[model samples]
Target: MNIFNRFIVTALLVLFTSKAFATSPIITKIERINVNTILVTFDQGIKPVSHFDVPIEGEFSVKLYTSTTYYLGSPNSLIVRTPTAVNPNDNGFATQWQWEEPTLTATDNDGLSEITINLNAYHSDFENDIGHSSLDYINTLNLIWQHDLSITSINTLDTNEGTNLEHTLIASDTAATFSIIENTSGLFSLSGANNATLSFDGTNTDYESTTKSYTVKIKATTGNDTNENTEQTLTVNIKDVTDTAPVIRRFTISQGVNQGRLIIKTDTSVTVYAEASGGSSYTWSSSDFSVIGSGAFVTFIPNADVGTRTIKLKVTIGDYSSERVLKLKLVESHPTDWKDKNNNGINDSKEIGRHNNELLVGENKKITSPINTRLLLGIMSEDTAHLTLAQMKKYRTDNNLSDNTEDTLTTGDIYNYVVENFSATATTQVIIELTSPIPANAILRKYSPATGWANFVINDNNIQSKTSNTCTDDTHWQTGLTTGATCLKLTIKDGSENDTDGDQNNGKGQVNGVVESTISIAIPAASNSNNNNNSGGGCVYNPNAPARFDMGFILLMTLSAYYLIRRRRCFNH
Candidate 1:
C-alpha cells in the first residue's frame, strides 16, 4: 500500500459519499420561508459514485421552508441512489426521490398568504425526477409538498317563485301578494333562509319604489371544510295575478213565468259568477247547482219547481275565483186566476174561499130560516110539494136533531127539510129569502101553503092556483094558493110560463103535481065477537057516502059527542 494509492481511495470514498448525500434528500426541520415560496436545503457530506449507487445508510435529514404559494411536484424530492459502488465513477446508477410537502405561511397583519409559486412551471419537472425512485430510497427521504385548492359555492331555495292569492274577489280592485325565491340548485345553504326578503320595483310603485328591477338576494354559506361566500339573485317579475277581484257590477237576471227563458246581464264581460274559486271558465248553474255551461256566457234552463230561480254566477280566473249573486226574478205572463187574497204567499184555504166567492155564482146563496144559515136550496121545477109532519119529524131525527122544535134549524137541517118536504112534481115556483144578499146565479125555492093544499101552477110571473081564479096576494107568499078547496094540487108542465113573475121558463111537461085533501068518511068496526066481548056495548056510526068536511068542525063535533056520552054514563051509574 503506497501513500498515493491510499489518497486515491480516500478521495474516491469522499466523493461517493457526497454524491449519495446529494441524491438522498431529507427534511430535518420545516420552516415557513414566505407566504408564496418554499425553499429546501440538502446535506452534501455523503456522496455516491453514480446516481444509481446504493447507500449504506437507510435515513437522511434535510430542512424545508414553505410559502403561501407553492408547486406540488415529485422532481423536487431527494432520495438514495441504488445499484452503484462506493467508487466515484459508475455508469449504471439509479437514484430514488420523494416529495416533501410544505405548509403555507400566513401573514401577520392580514389573514391572507402573501407568497405564491407558479405551479404550472414546475409541475412537469418535479414529476420526471421523483417518479423513477426506488421504494426503499423514496421511503427514507423526508420531503414536504404544497398545493393551492379552490372551492365553488352556490345558493338554493326551498320554495317556488310565484304569487300567492289568498282572497276571492268580487270587484277589480283586489290586491295580490308575491313571494320572491332564490334557487341554489342544492349547491349551497342560506345563512338566513327564512329571513331572506324580496324587494320590488315596477309600475306598481305602491308595493316598492326601487325601479331597478325586482330581485331577491340570498346570503348563503357552503361546505364546513372551507370558508365560502355564495350569493344568488332571483329575478322577480310580479305578473298581474288578476288578484283584483273582477267587478261584477250590476248583475241581474230576468226570467219569465213557468220556467221560461232567463236573460242575464252584467256590467263585466264575465257575466256568470259563482261561489267557488279558481276556475278559468265560468259554470252557470241552475237551482240544482249543477254546471250547465262552462264559458264566459251561459244560459240556464230552470225546472218546473224553479219558477223564478235566483242563480249564482261563478267566474274563475287562474288560481283566483269570484262570484256575484244575481236575482232571477220571474215575470208572470198572465195573472193567476187564483191568487193569495189573504195576503199570504201561499194559496191557502182562505184564499181559495175568496176566489170562489169572486168566480162562483152560487157561493153567496144560503139558508136564512136557521140562525146560522149555510143551506142552499136549488129548485129545478115549480111543481114541488111540502112534506108530511111524520116525514118531517123522521128526517129531523135522522139528521142528529136535538129537539123536534122548528125554531132552531141549522143550515144543513133547513136544506134537509126543504129537500125532504118538497116533491119534484112539476115546474114548481119558490121564493128564497136569504140571510145575506145572494151571489149571482143562485137558485132558491121555498114556499108555505096558506089554503087548500096550495094548488100552484108555475107561471112566468108567479105561482098561481090551477083551478081557482082567486086573486091571491103572493108578495109575502113565497109559494102558496089563495083559493080554499078540499085538496091542494100542483101541476108542472114542460112549457115556458108567460105570467106576472119574472122567473126563468123552460120546456113544457116537466112540471109535477102534489095533492092535499080532507074528507068525512067512516071506517067499519071489527066484527069479531071476542074483541067486542072485552068492551061494553056502544053505538058505532057509519057514513053512507064520502063527504068533504072541515077538519076543525069535525074535531069539535067529536069532542062534544064524547062529553054527552060521558054524562049519560055517569047518570046511569
Candidate 2:
C-alpha cells in the first residue's frame, strides 16, 4: 500500500461525515398555529426539499412549503398544513409524523446531503399544543343562525283584549335564549320556555280612537357572546268592534194599582221591574234609600208620608248606558166608600159593625173578605177562566157536588166569587160595590152546577150606582148611589137563591149549611140588549136579546124612510 492511497481514503471518510452533519435539521419546537396548520421551528435556517407526508384520510395538499432559497439567509421555521381539521383527541398524530411519514425531506441552502427528521423528540410538546387547537378560533370563530326568526301568521286581533302571538327562534347553538330588545308602547312582553311567547297586555282596546298596532324587536343569544346572536322585529295589529247603545223596553208594577198612574198606601211595598235589552249591567237608585232598592227589580216601599217619589234605573253595556226614571205616588190611607160622621178618621157605620162584612175592592181587580172567610171575587179573562175551569170541576167532583151543564160564559173580564158564612134563606144579602159605574153593555149571570149558567135574578129596587160623581166628604155615599145606579144588591130567598156552587163550606170559611153559592158576572159578546126572562124577580137581565130586536126595527125604519122619499119626489114631478 502506498502512503498516498491511505491518506486519500481517510480524507474521503472525513469529508462525507462533515457533509452529513451539516445537512441535518435540529427541531427546537413544534406547535399548532390554526385548525388546519402546524408550525415547526428549527435551530438554523432551513429550505424545503420534499413536501410534508400526512395520513391520507381526507382532501389534503402535501406541498405545504416549497422554497429554493433560505428565508432571510436563515430559515428556522416550517409551516405544515393538515389533511383536514385536526382532532385534538388524536394522540397518534405525532407518532405518524415520527414513523409513518417518509416523503417529507429537507436540505441546507447549498443542497448538500438530504435529511429526514424523526419528529419524536418533539412528540410530548407537539401533542400538548395540538390538544388546544380550539384556542385558534379566538380570531375567526363566527356564529351562524339557522332560521330567519320571522313570524308568519295573522297578527290582527279583535279589540277585545287577551290575545297572544307565538314565535320560535333557532340558532346554531341550542343553548341560545330569546329576549325582547325593544317593545313599542311597552304593550308586548316575552315569556315561556326559550322566551317563545309574545303576549300583549290588554290595557286599552279602543282601536278606533287609539293606537291600533305595536312593534317589538327580539334577540337570541348565548351568554355574552354578541357575535353569535340574531335579532328579529315583530308586529301585531288590532281591529275595531262596533259599540251599540242599550235600550229600555218597559216598566211594570207587581203590586198597587196601575190606572195610568200608580197609587199605593203607606206600609205597602211594590215590586217594580224594568225590562231592558242590550245591556251588561242593571242599577237602580233613588234619592231616598229607604223608599227603593237596587237592580232591575226593585222594591218600592212608601213611608208614613203622602206624596210622590222618584226612582231611577240605569242600564249599562261597556261604554254605553241608558237610564229611566219612575215616579211613584204614596198615600196615607186606604180608599173606602164609608162615611166618617163623628169627625173621627174611622167610619161611624164601620165602628158599629154595620160595614164590618163589607170588602173594599183593590186595583188587582179582586175583592174578598178577611182570609176569604165570607167571599172571594176576581175579574179575569176567558183564558184564565178556562185555566181554572178544570180546578173548579175537580172540586165539584171531589165534593160530590152536582155536575155543571151550563153554557159557556164569554166576553169581558168574568167576575167570579164564592159566598160563605151566609144564609140561603131570604134573610141574608150581599152587595158588590165598584169604583166606577157598570157599563150598559155589561150583563150579570150566575153559573150553578145544578142549573148551569143563567141571568142573575135580583131586585131592581135594591140597585145603586154612581156615574161621573166625586165624593169629597165621607157622607157623600160612596159610589154616588144617589147620583146614578152602579151598585148591585143581591138578596137570598130560598136554598136556591143564586146558589151556583154546591161547595157546602164555600172554599175556606165558616159553613152555615150543607150547600153554598158561587156568583159570576158575564157580559154578552157584541150585544147591548136586555133579557126579559125572569124566575121570581121582575128584573130583566138579558145582554144578547137586544141586537135582534134592534136590527128588525132598523130595517122597518129604513123601508119607511125610503117610501116617504119616493112619494115626495113623485109629488114634486
Candidate 3:
C-alpha cells in the first residue's frame, strides 16, 4: 500500500473531476428556416470532420470543428466535439453544421429542442500536453437543437393625446430582445434588454386633429436566426375630447349710423346677432316673448308704446351656452305723419293735448305718448306793449294760431303770439308752475329771435307766494325786458363759474344751463320800482347791460375830486 500506488490513484481522480465539471456549449438556435434547412448555434466551436463515404439509408454526414486560438480564461477557452458519429478536426471549430437524418422533418419537430456535443479541456489542460485527445472524452455539450424557436406579439395599443406611452401589455416572448423596426408616427419606443417594453409619446403634434391612428413595426430577436427575421405591426389608436361652449359678440341694438340711444320709432324693427367658433347656433327671445324670433339675423319689432323693453338671446355650441340682454326704448312717430304710437287707437292727441290746449309750431315734437301730468307754461312781455291782448289776438288770427287762452293764457296761446310777432315791444310779469318741487336753482330766461338766450329780470320785484313748484316775477316797463324778445325759457342752472357775474338779473347767470319748461312773453301791466337802480329811463338789459358796471362811476368821481382839489390849491396860491 505504498506511495507508488497512492500516486497513481490520485492522478486518476483529478483527471475524472476536471472532465465532469467542464463547461457545456450553449444552445442558441433550434428552429427550421424552411422544410429542407435546419439551423443550429452554440457558444463554443465544433471540431470539423470530412464527409464520409458510406451513407446510412436516408442520412448524410455531419461536419464539426474546434476553435482554440483566440479565447481566454477557464470556461472561455473550452472546446467542443460532435456526437460519436462525427470526428473532431485539428485546428477548427464549427457552430454551423450540415446534418441529414431520415427521421427528421419540419412537421415533426416544430418547437424548441437541443443537440448534444462533447466538451474537452483547454489546450493548456491537454492530456499529455497533446492537441488530438478530444475524441476520447464522454463529457457532453448540449445546444439548441434544430426543432423550433420563435416569438409572437400583442400588436395593438390605445391611448389618448398628451398621455405617456408605457405599455407593458404588449404580449411577446420572454426570450427575445425587443426593438422598434418601424415607427412612422414617431410615437413608439423601446427600453430594457431581454423582452423590452413598448413606449409611446403622444403629444398634440402626434395627433393632428381630434382622433388619429398610428402604425409601428416591431421585431423580437434571440440572435439565433440568420436567414431572415420576423416583424409585426402595432396599431396605435388615439382618442380625443369634445368642446362645449358658445359666445355672443353683440347683445344690444346699440349700432348703425342713424340710431340714437337704443331707441327706435314705433312700428320700427331692429336686428341682433351672436357668434361662436365651434359651429354653434343661437335662439332669440324678448322679455315680451311675442316681439322677437330666433335666427342668425333675427328681427324684433319694438313695442308700440313709449317705454323701456328688454330683449334676450341664448347661444350654444356643443354642450356649452351663453345668454345676453338688450335694454331698449320705443317712442312716438314724427308729428307731420303721426301714427297711433301708443297702440291705444289715439293718434297724437294725448301728446299734443299735454301742452295747455294744443301743440305749438316748431316746438319739441317728440314726446312720450302716455304722459299723466299737466304741462303748464306761460309768456311775459318786453318793456313796452309787445304782448298786448290786441296785438296777440291779431297775430293769432293772422297765423291761424289757437286762442286757447280763455281760462288763463295757455302755452299754445303765448307760443303762437311770439312766433307771429317778435318785434312787438312791452314789459311784463313772468309766470311759472310745476306739479312737484322744481329742481333747485332754476331761473327764467328770454330767447330773442334776433339774439340768443338771455336772463329774464324783474326790475320792480319778485311777486307771488313762491310755492314749492311755482314762482311769479313781476317786471316794470322801464327795467325789465327788451322791446320784442321772442321766447321765454325756465330751466335748472346749478350755478357754474361760466353762468354769470352775479349782476343785472335776479342774482342769476347769463345762461339757463338746462331747459325745464318754456313759452313766449306777453306784456304785463306793471310799473317800475321807485328804487334809484331802475328809475333812469334806460334799457334794463338782463345780462351784458351798461348799468352792471359801477366801477366806471367810482373812477370818474375820483378823477373829478382830484381836479377840483387842484383848482382849489391854485386859487389859494
Candidate 4:
C-alpha cells in the first residue's frame, strides 16, 4: 500500500466522473410559439446521439445528447436526420455536430455552451444542430398561420314575395364576415356581422332576380389584425316567388242572356265567366241563394222564386284576389198565343188594375206609348194588386175607369175587363202533337195577331202547340185546314245555342207546318165555339155522332129513338 498505488485509483475515479457529466444534457426552459411549435433552451451544450444521411424522408429518431434514458422532444415528431458538420470520432465520441437547420434558427458564441433553438423550425435536419442553447427566444414570440378556408355557393332559396337566400361562411379566425368585391353590378348586399352567429343580416330577396347569384371577397384575421390572415370567397343566392295579383278584364255569360242581364229560365245550368289575369281559383256567390255559383269560370243556378239578382265572382292568384259582379233577372212567361203588345213579357190586357200607387195604365204608363206599353201595364197592375179597397176607388177616378165596389181589385177581374173591352182577338188553342221530344232548354213561341212573338210553355215537351182560332165545347175540329189559314205561327228553339229571334220568323211553323199527329188540349178557349169551320156554319153540330156524318143523321136518330121507346113500352104491357 504505497503512495503510488493510491494515486492510480484516485486518477481512475476522477476520469469516470468527468465522462459521466459530459454524456448527459439538462433542459431548463421551454417557450411555446404556437400550438405546434416551441423554443427549447438548455443549461449545457449537447452532442447528437446519432447522425445518418437518409436517402428519403422516413421514420427515424435522434437526440441532442447521447444518454441511457432521456429525450427532449416528442418521438412522433421525429422522422429523419441530416449529416452533421462535425462528424463523430472513430471511438463514437465527439464534442458536437455542426448546427445548420433552416428551421432551427439559433446563435452560438462559445462552442457547445449555450444556444437559441426554435422548435417551429424543427425538422429532422435540425437534430444535433451543434449550437449552444439558451433562453433568448422568450423575448421574441410570434404566430404564423398556414391553414386555408373557403366558401361554397348556396342554391334554391325561397320566399312568397321573391327569393330570400342565406350562405354560411366558415373561417379559422375569431369571427367570420363577408364583403362584396367581385360583383360587377353591385346588386348584392354582403353583410358582415361579428357575433359568430349562424345567420347574417343586410341581405334580402326583394331587390334581386329569381335565378341569379353574386360573389364576394372577404379577409379573415386570426384573433387580431396582425400578420396572420387568410383571404376567402363568398356566394349569395336570391330567388323570386309569386307576386302578381289577379285582374278581371272581361265578363261573359254562358247562358240565359237577354240584353245585358241574364234571363234565367227553367234550365238548371247558367254560368258566368270572368276573363282575368293570373287566376288559379274562383269563388262565386249571389246576393241570394236562389242563384248560387261555384268554382273558377263559375256556374250558377236559379231557384223557383223569380226576381232580379246580382251575381259575384272572385278570382285569386297567389296571395291576391279580385271580384266582379253581374246583374240577372227572371221574368214570367206566357203561352205562345198571349199578346204582350209592348214586348214586356206580360199580357197587355192584364194591366188594368186600380193601384195603391197613383200610377195608371193610360197616363204616365200611357196605353198609346210606343216604348213598352205592356210592361208599363204589368207594373201598374202589380202595384195595385196590394192596394186596399178604399184606394181602388181613388185610382179608378184618377184614370177615368169604372169604379170597382168589390173589396179588392183582383188580377183576374182587371185582365178580363180589359180583354172584353179591347178590340184584340183572343186565341182558341188546339194541341198539335210532334214526333220528337224537345229539350228542356227548348223555347216554345208563337207570332200571330193574338200574340206578338213571345215565349210559351210547351206541354208534354213538344207534344202540343196552341192554335190561333178560338173555340168552345167542340173537342174535335175536322183536320183539313189549309196552310196559314189559322194564322197561328208556332216555333220551338233551343235558346242555349245561337238561335235568335229575328222578328218572328226564326223557327216559325204554321197550322200546316206543325202537327205531326192529331191531338187535343184542355186549355180553355174564348167564345164563339165551333169556330174551326172556315166553311161557315156548315159544320153541323151534333152532341154525339159518327166520325164523318153530322146533324143530317139527327132527324133519323130522333125518329128511331122514339120507335125504340114505344116498342119497349108495348113489350112490357
Strongest candidate by TM-score: 4
lDDT tens readout by residue for model 3, 439-496: 2223334433222234444333332223322122333222222233222222223222
**Residue-by-residue lDDT tens digits, candidate 2, 1-573:** 799999999999998887655433344544333222334444443221122453323211222222454321124543233332222223333212211122222223334332222222221222222121111110111112134323333334343533444545454456667788887678877777777666777566466656777777777776555455677676666664425445454455545433212345655566777666556788888875354546677776655344445577777888977555554544455356433332112234434442334333423122323321243221111111111455556545544566673444453223444343332232344554544455554556655554556665556433233332322112323321342333444544434545443332442211122123344444454332344234344444455445546688799999999999999999999
**C-alpha root-mean-square deviation, candidate 3:** 29.4
Off by over 4 Å in 2: 1-373, 376-409, 422-426, 433-437, 460-463, 467-487, 501-515, 528-573
In model 3, where do residues sit more than 4 Å from their true spots?
A: 1-244, 251-263, 289-294, 333-573
lDDT of each: 0.30, 0.44, 0.39, 0.36
Lowest-sum lDDT 10-residue window in model 2: 132-141
Higher-TM-score candidate among 3 and 4?
A: 4
Each model's total of backbone clashes: 72, 8, 32, 13
lDDT of 1 by residue, 286-345 (tens): 563333555554544433232334565656566654444343322233235323222112
lDDT of 4: 0.36
Cα displacement (Å) at residue 1, model 3: 99
What TM-score does candidate 3 reach? 0.22
Q: In candidate 1, how many clashes are counted?
A: 72
